[model samples]
Structures are given as structure tokens and as C-alpha cells.
Target: MKFDTIIIGGGLSGMTCAAMLAKNGQKVALVTAGQSCLHFNSGSIELLGFQEGKVVERPFEGIAQLNEAHPYRKIKTEKLAVYAEEARTLLAEAGLKMKGNAEKNHFRLSPIGTTIPAWLTLEDLITLETTAELNGKKLLLANVEGFLDWPTAYLSDSLSAMGANVKTASFTTEALAFARKSPTEMRAINIAKYLDKAQNIADAAREINRLGKGFDLVLLPAVLGLAHDNVDLLRKAVETPVECVATMPPSVSGIRIENKLRGFLGQHGAVVLNSDTVNNGFFEGDKLTAITTEKLEETRLEANQYVLGTGSFLSGGLVSDYQTITEPALHLEVEAHESRTQWTSEYLFDEQPYMAFGVKTTDDFHPMKDGKAVTNLYAIGSVLSGNSGIKQATGTGVSMLTAIAVAHNILNQ
Candidate 1:
């Protein structure tokens, strides 16, 4: 099939780019072998959580000091500012409203009651300046009947030690009848789906009213809703403010955002083909003309522009073997140490050198081969080298920013 742009990998980066490009009037197709990492995320967009072993208060300031080779540096400061604002607007319009901004990072409580700095968090999350803020607040945690992803009692105890009036209340089996009716024990996603229905949410809200009386705020597990914004519905039903704490994956929050993006892009006419991996690229001189997929080897997907966002080793953009590491698709040049021993630090908690390994690219995000740029083909997200998304807590940020940059570059062309 012919198109203006073909994005390999339907992960966050690829989908973000696809949506932007399609909105800008480019015909886009996104291909992926499996589900995106969004399903495994904590629903928070973390940007530069740590700097030189120190916690960062402001991520925008942190980006200024990033090494020249880091991916964020490629987009330039002015463009990054525009991209950040645009990304926030797009996400909010897609129905996954987020809080926080570029001025500073906000702290959100984790499942263990510890706070972590995040650039953008869902509006349903209770953000705090410090653990001390929880002190004296009448906080009630609503634990689902069989959800074991987080220990409510332990978290409540931890909060209590910090001077907060924390208490735990369980949603009895009858209250969670919607979840208990499932063939298997309810997971985060299942609970979220059940809560998506207005009737089920109203019923649960009534139950919360009975069990969560006199609390300043009711805290529920992240399974607030999946199909729609149930946070508002549930909040209105109970006539009290509600917040969701982070839980283990399949993250309901992440799925909600992913589904919203998918629906938004679908409405804009972008074709998303999952379970299809790009196997090889056909190049004419320095520009890629077409790509072949694993499922459809005989068919070539032709496009004027291509984006390689297959992600790092975790997503199979770069492959590591006993002898060497390689970028299998198009055999793009990978940036890494010559030996495996140098890939990691001696200390486990210290920065791992291997985390920064991926395809080396130019400022324009075109993959580099033997010190020359590969024309017409752009690389973004975890696939780009010179920065550690995991170490810096910049995975989603890097992916979204780079995707926006790539889309703008393509549009400008």
C-alpha cells in the first residue's frame, strides 16, 4: 500500500506520530507485532526522575543540562517547548486529561506510599508536594474485594506513620458483584471495564458512601474506568472527591489513554495494523522506498517517509546476542560498547551503560550508517541512542517528544 508516511511499531511513539501526521493531513499506517508498552506503564509520564543520583524537581531544567548526544537535545529547546504543549493539548482532547506541566514536576504517591516526581499524571491521581501533606487528611482507601496488586493495609500503615489519618475499607463481595461474576478473579483491567458501565459505577458509589463516610477523600485502586471517564461519574455519585492509586499492570489508566488515542486516530482515518512486524526495508540509494512485513512478505508497504520506532531491546528494535548487539531491521548502525562487560556498572543501582544503547541518529532523527544519514527514514523513541530512558525515567517523554519532532520534520518537508 502507498502512503505519505509508514510508522513501524504501534507503540506509544509510533501511535503519537501517526495521530499527529494524520491530523496534519498525511496518510499514515502503523504496523506492530504486539501490544504497546502502555499496557505495562504506571499511567504517569515521568521525565528525568533522577539526575546524577539526585531526585530532580524540575524536568524542563534537567533537559537543559542533558548531554549533547541525548535524544532531547535533538529537538532543540524552542521546538521541545512547542511539542510539550501540543502533546498535552492532544492528550486532553483525546479524553485522557493530565495534570502538571513543564514548569515543574509533581509528586504522586506510589502503591507503597512513597512519592515520585512525574511530569504529567492523570487528573484522578492525588498529587502532593510531600508525604507531610497527607498528614491530618482523613484519607480512606477503598480496596476491591479480590484485587491483590497492592497491599492496602501496608500502604495505610505507611501513611499513618507519616501522620496521616489513613484507613482501609474493603468493597464487600456483594458490592463487587460485577467483578466477582467474571470467570477468573478480577484484575485491574477487568475491574476498570466493569466500572465503565454507569449503573455499576453508581452502585459502587453508593457502597462507597456507606463504607467511606466522614473521610476527606476516597482513594480507589487505579481501576476507576476503562471505556469512559468514570472518575467524574463516580466522584459525582459519591458527592466526594476521589483519587486512584497506582496499581500493577495491565494498567487501567494506560489502557484508557491508549484506547482514546486509537479511537481518535481511527476517526482521522489512520490504519493501524497490529501483529505485523516489519522484516526489512527496500532502499533506493540513501532513501527507503518500501518495507516488507513478516506476515506479508510478498507485499511491500511503500511510503514517502518512514519512522522506525520499534523501541529498545525490550521492544525488539535492537537485538543482543552472545557475540554482538544489532538492529536487525534495515541493519541500522547501533551505538554501543564493543564489549558486554562495559555495558553495565559494577553496582546494580548505578547507571547501566547498556540502557543507552540503540540506533545512532543525527539531529534530524535520521538513522546514521557509517557516519552518514539515511535519507527519508527517521528514528524515534527507545530506538534512538545516547540516552537512558529507564535510568532517567524519561521513557514516555522521550518517545512522545521524538515522535512529535519526527512528525513536524516530515510535515515541514
Candidate 2:
């Protein structure tokens, strides 16, 4: 198989690039090993959470202060803003509407009773600009009968401490029966799939109405729907505003958005090959010419340009064997310390050097080898060195913006 572009990972970064390129009439092929990190996503694009132990109010303003090796420093702030807005518009057009502005960050509650600062989030997410906004409001926190992801009691206590009039409610055993999974096996995805059915949604709405009365807004688990949006259904049924709190992995919000984007990409002309891992690539004079996957024996996929969005250690793009760290598929040189002891800090949350280990890249996103750029190969996402995405809370934003930048470069070239 041959195409204009072959993307080696099917996460948000690869999919966005494939969609954009295909929409512009490029023949694109997207290959993936399996499901993406989206399944574990918090369903929000966090530009930057903290800088030097201080929370960032406006992310763009801090980009200029980041170190020279930081990835954000390579991309102009204006381009970053444009990419974020474009990403929002793309997801909205695909049916997973998002909310937030380009210049500011907002706060949303996580399942563990922590507040997460994000640049953009789902429309159904509950965000409060300040704790003062909750002072005079009555709030309802909903708990699913079988799901243990959200601790409603703890959340209620936290909210009460924040000056809100808070109450806790639960979906009854009868309503939760639709989940099908036993309590021992039940999870957010099961509940979300059950809620996706119209009949089950109606039943849930009835229960919510009875339990959520007199509340200004109802905060439910993220398990509203799996492949569909059920926020409006519950809102209409209970005649009250409703929002969802981020839950544990098998994120319903993330699944919904991924489903929408996958469908959109399929419709646009990108051929997505899931459960396929690229085992080897044919390179000629610093240019990757073709790739062969584990599943295919006789065929090789050739492309004019290639994108590596395979992600970091967690996603199998980079691997460590205690003695050394290396990129598995391409054997790209990693930027890391020679001594393993220097890779980590005493405090896990501190600036750990190993967290930033990945392939070195140029400003144009091209992977570098011994100080020279690989002409036709580009790397993006967690696979790029110099940024600890988790510490900065810029994982999704980096993926989106870098993907957009790569797509723009490819199109312009």
C-alpha cells in the first residue's frame, strides 16, 4: 500500500493530522497498535497547569518564559492559540462540543476531589471560576450504585467546605440494573453504555428528577453515555442544569470524543488500520521510505511523508531496560542522562529528568540524529523530548497543537 502520508500512531495527534491532511485532499493511512491514551484521558485539554510551583492563569503568557528546550518555546504563541481554536472547532463540528476561551484556563472537579485546570473542556463539564460562585448555590452530587470511581461523600464534603449547599444522591439498584455488570465487575464504561440506550436514559432521568429536586445544578459521574451525549436528556428530564465530573479510566467523555473524531476521519477519506504495529521501516539516506507492520507479510506501506505519534514509554514508543532507554521501532537517539540515578528525583512529582526522555526533534518537528534532521520523518506528542507532559498538564494541548503544526507544514511544503 502507498499513500501521500502514513501516520504511525492513532492517538489524538495522529488522528487529527490524518483528518486535516485528508480533508485537504491528501491520501492518508493511519496505523495503530491498539486503543489510544484517550481511554485514560481526563477529557480536557490542559495547556499548562503549573509553572515553578505557581498555577498559571493564562498559558500563552507563560510560553515565552519556558526554557529553550521546551516544545512550546519552539511554536509561536499565536500559532498555539490558533491551533487550539481550530481543534475546538473540529471537535465541535464532529458533535463533541467543547467550551473555553483561547486566553484563559478554567477549573473542573476530578473524581478524586481535586480541581484540574484546563484550557478547553466538554460543554457538559462543570466549571466554576471561583469558590465564591458556589457560596449561594444548591448542588446535587450523584453517585452510581455500582461504580466506585467517584466518591460522592468526599466530593460533597469538599463542596460544603467550599461554601456550597451540597447534597448527595444515588441511582437506585433498579436503575443501575441496566449496567448488566455485577458490582464486582462494573465500571464507568458499563454504566455509560447502559445510559446510551434511550429507555435507560429515560429511567435514569426519572430517578434524577426525583432525587435532584430543588438543586441549582446536578453533578453526576462522567458515565452519562458511551457513544452519545446524554447531558441534555437528563437536563430536560429533571428540568435542571446538569454537569459531569471526570471519572477514572475508560473515560466516557474521552470515548465520546474519540468516537466522533474517528467517524469524522473515516468519512473524510483516511484509511485507519487498527491493531497493526509497524515493526520495521525502510530508510534511504535519512529518509523513511516504507514501513512493514506485524500483521502484513507481503505488503509494505510507502508514503512521501511519515509522522511518528507513537507516544512515550507508556504507549510503547520509548522503552527502558534499566541500563538504557531507546525508541523501539526507529532506533532514534533519545535525549536522556547517561546515569540511571540521575533520571529521577527523590520526589516523584518534582522535575524528573526521565519523564522528558524521547527522540530529539527540530523546530519543524523533524526527528534529529547526531545533530542532523531526518528529512522526511517527523515526530510529535509524548515521543518528543524536553517536556514532562504530566507535570505541566499540557499533554492534550501539546498533542493537538503539534499535530496541527505538522499538518500545516506538510500542506505548505
Relative to the unseen true structure, what is the C-alpha lDDT of residue 331 in candidate 2, on a scale of 0 to 100? Answer: 78
The per-model lDDT (C-alpha) reads: 0.85, 0.83
Of the candidates shown, which would achieve the greatest lDDT relative to the real structure? 1
Q: Model 1, range 1-413, lDDT digits (tens) per residue? A: 99999999888898899989999899999998877888987778876777787788888889999999999999878887789988898788677889988678888777777777888898887787665887788989988887888679777887788788988887853546655776474888777777777888888888888888788888989887778878888888896678888887778878877888888889889988879998888876788889999888889899999999999888888999876889888888999999988888999888999899999888899997656788899999999998788778888999999999999999998
TM-score of each: 0.95, 0.96
Q: Which sections of candidate 2 miss by over 4 Å?
A: 173-175, 178-181
List, residue by residue over 168-251, the lDDT tens digit for candidate 2. Answer: 877754547744456754788888777777878888887778888788988888888887888887778777778888887878
lDDT of 2 at 209: 81
In terms of TM-score, the best-performing candidate is: 2
Worst 10 residues of 1 by lDDT: 172-181
